[model samples]
Target: MTRVRHWPTLAVLAVALALPHFTRGTQTEFAIEVMITGMFALSLNILIGRLGLISFGHGLFLGVGAYLAGFMLRHLSENLFLLLAAALIVGMLVSALVGAMVLRLGGVGFVMITIAFCQLFYVLVLSTQTWSGGINGIPSIPRPKLWRGTDLPAWLSLDSEFTFYYVALVGLVLLVYGLKRLDASPLGSVFSGIRQNAARMRALGYPVRRFQLIGFVMAGSLAAVAGALHASLFGLVDPSLLFWTTSGEVILMVILGGVGVLYGPLVGAALFLALFHYLGTLTDHWRLVLGIVFVVVVLYAPNGLVPLVTNALGRWRGAKPSARGAAVALPEDAT
Candidate 1:
């Protein structure tokens, strides 16, 4: 029974693992992009779904990680792990500072303040041409080295799309597994409590705001990791990452996938990207089609596609009893 409950996710993971074997290398870029985007969306989910905080500038941290990583790779170190550590540290610091400043504001105020902070960084980057490369962004961004040693390992190289795709894919898997475990942890219970009733949590002596900050910092830091992956994937760090629209896209992904569900954002990112990829070639006004689809999903399937599909399938199956149950129907009579 426990296995039955988990089989869907396991099935999806199996498909993900087997994808590269079945698909062409050309599809590797798309797979990597989906994994990265899914990570970003899920990170934001920690805020919107669990913490009940809607940030409009989550991408600010992403930009920070990307630009910092690009700068480090070009001028300092090529070690990927080192760059990731740097990104994580910088993201935590920046998110903590920003969270401290804006977390006091609730509802719309928090959203507005976040936008302001992101804009500030955006303009700051745009103004510093030598530092951030201004509006043009940091070009020729180098890929990080897997190791800092003289001889490279037998099994690591970011230059190969095949290798990097699996790297990011494995990362996504681990993230989902960790988050699933976290969902069952005491901290997750606290987060769920806070989401349900912040005032009640405060009455119980839980530092609600502090928890929110922790969640914010955690989300932002994870987002920065996603940004680093994005930079590595494209070999460029751009101003578009910090743009408000980028945050909006993640919001869309969460909505499309289903907020509050761990794997929802991933499914959402995949679906959203599918639309963007397929709809894009069909017409220049692809966004219009995408918007319509989004609206349809929101109106008809408010819980997002995952739950909707799952429940619908459950109902269809439930409507028909299995023959095995009938074969054992001595049930009430036997008792």
Candidate 2:
């Protein structure tokens, strides 16, 4: 019965698995970007959907992973495992420090502090030319190999774009699966409780800050993983990747995708990337169209595109509206 309920997810996965077979060159690259963006947005959603907190500087974590990965690839080695592990570990450390200081603030204050942290790193990158490549950013980062100076077979290397696509897809799938399990765990309940009433949770003696930091670390580490993948994808890491606008774009992704639903980021990323790629080909002012669409979503469907689309589909099927990103709904196993 549960399997019957998840047909759509399975169908989507089937399509993703077969994506490379159907598309070539730019289209395949675009699909890769979509998966990467989806994971990036999913990282931000960890805080937004689960904790009901928004961090404007979340891109800082992405940048950290990207820059560090680029550095490691350039000066260290192309070992895939080492690069990813380094990125994730550094992201965890940085986010732990940031969360410890900023998680104490609530609402707007928290958002502002996060933005401040992001910008601090942004300017620091600009000023430190020897380390981060300054405004020029790091370029021509190498793809991941199995390990440095190891006799491992080349099949383990991620040199082929076709190979990396599967890797990205697998990473995104694992992240979603992990988050779903997290939702079903006791920790998820505490997060849900904190979302409803932090004060009540605190009264019950739950160490709210610790849990928030854990979520932050999880999201940060994943963002780093996304960043490392991105570095390999383009062989470049731009300073703008750390910009506040990057965070804003991710936040928009979360809002456009249903906030609470685990798979919503993939949907939103596909739409956003399609619009971005197609509209940019037509005109330079593509952001204007995005801005208009964002305003429409905000003014009309504040609950997000998922609920609207799902509710319409549900009406045809005579099922109830999916409680994706709804503030009041008790979060289910996934959403």
The residue-by-residue lDDT of candidate 2 on 107-178, one tens digit each, is 778888899999999999999999888999998887888656666665676666678789888888998999
lDDT of 2 at 200: 76
Indicate the residue-level lDDT of 296 in model 1: 97
What would the per-residue lDDT of candidate 1 be over residues 1-335, giving only the tens digit for each residue? 99997797789889988887776765878999999999999899888877778889998988998998889988998787888888889999999999999898887788888898888899999999988999999989877768776577645658777778788998788788878887799998888788777878889999988998989999999899889889988889999899888888898998887877777899899988988898888988989988998999889987777767766776688854322111101111100
Q: What is the C-alpha RMSD of each candidate to the true structure, in Å?
A: 8.1, 3.2
lDDT of 1: 0.83
- Candidate 1 regions exceeding 4 Å error are 149-155, 319-335
Candidate 2: stretches off by over 4 Å: 147-155, 324-335
lDDT of each model, Cα atoms only?
Answer: 0.83, 0.84
76: Cα error in model 1, Å? 1.4
Q: How does model 2 fare in lDDT?
A: 0.84
TM-score of each model, in listed order: 0.92, 0.93
